[model samples]
Target: MDPTNSSTSLAFEVAVFNPSIIVGPVVLGALVDTCLFGCLVIQTYVYYANFANDHRAIRFTVAAVFATQIAHVMCVSATLWNTAVSAYDDPSKLQMLPLASAATILFTGITGALVESYFAFRLWNVSKKLLLPILSMVLCVIAQVVSLVITVQAFKTTSVAEFEVDQNTPITLALTSRVLCDLILTLSTAWYLKNQRSGYLRTTNMIDRLVLWTIETGLITRYDERRRSWRV
Candidate 1:
């Protein structure tokens, strides 16, 4: 490669790696997640606030739920910021991208799993009838870990910089775990809402909408999963 041509090609790559373009979506997603999770936190607090005879466990549960959501939002935002800046700084460096990508993907899945576990706890508290939800969540965790291991192995391929990762690698694992987690959480909420001793209309509606948004965000609808969607 001619030195001058190589420099020009590298400059074009830098220009295409504009931080603003990709960062905008990340920031937007973070804000939307914040809004949804924040609303849930407030809703949970209000539900507990009116408890004239609140148990210690209920209070503790409320606190744990709030903390989990906050932690997830913060982790996601931090990951986005790190990934965006690193990409802008060195677009051609696959190693750097993978570092941030792996962290973001792993933490995001873990956060979602924790959220599902919390909901599972709530389901068990509400009804002894459905041990199935908790079982499903446990199975999902096992599957997610297996997928993550495969993705890590794929990244170990020599000259990953020249090799584009298909949707079947780490990204797929992350999204699959995320969707399954959302499904578990959504089912738990639906079960609770249906079986509530006295339903609160506002809270039920909010939970429904939030879970729907979660499903939409977590599931990669841009590509068809039923068909193998990849080009490399």
Candidate 2:
């Protein structure tokens, strides 16, 4: 083979792969993830500082979630480094999914499930209703299992194209379950809180604020999941 011809062919193939399409999103995601991690750190600090007298189970849960978040950040950072730096001139390397990338899926699912479970518990405590919280937990488990399957398939796949083709159904299922779970939690909590309003100005205001917060957070998460589905 003529050396020049071989080099030109590889370049053409790399161009077709469009590294920017992959690298751009990865970089943007990592930056957003890091920013969110910073927020979590601040929140964790505040929780420990102000809620020192919280129940042991609650404190332990907070600590565990914080640790998981740290690991998630590390995995995301590694994936970013691999995509933007380590794989910089190698299109084949870019095409293959990094181990860290797959690991991030697992970690993300874990962190999400834990947080959702905690919220579901809180909903159950306040509303004294078992159905919504139970449904939320079930959805969380489904999403988590789907994530695990995706991660495992990612490990087995040799390239991004292959993984996407194979995991499309699971990905859709996972996103759907997550959005549903968030929706249930948000609406149920807001409804229960609204019903608890005692007509006292101060107490009603507090409940109103909580309802707004729940709805806002739920919409944000649902929107995010929808975006992910669009991307997929």
Report clash pairs, candidate 2.
none
Report the lDDT of model 2 for residue 16: 53
Among all windows of 10 consecutive residues in model 1, the one with the lowest summed lDDT is 158-167
Error of 1 at 210 (Å): 41
Tell how far residue 83 is off in model 2, in angstroms: 0.7
Candidate 2 stretches with Cα past 4 Å from truth are 1-18, 198-232
- lDDT tens digits, residue span 1-232, model 2: 9999988855755555556688999999999999999999999999999999999999988998999989999999999999989988876698878999888998889888988999999999989989999999999999999999998998787677557667889999999999999999999998888777654667879999999999999999999999999999
lDDT for position 192 in model 1: 72
Can you give the TM-score per candidate against the true fold? 0.48, 0.78
Q: Could you tell me which 10 consecutive residues in candidate 2 have the lowest summed lDDT?
A: 9-18
**lDDT agreement of model 2 with the native:** 0.89
lDDT value, residue 9 of candidate 1:
54
lDDT of 1 at 82: 61
Local error of candidate 2 at residue 12 (angstroms)? 16
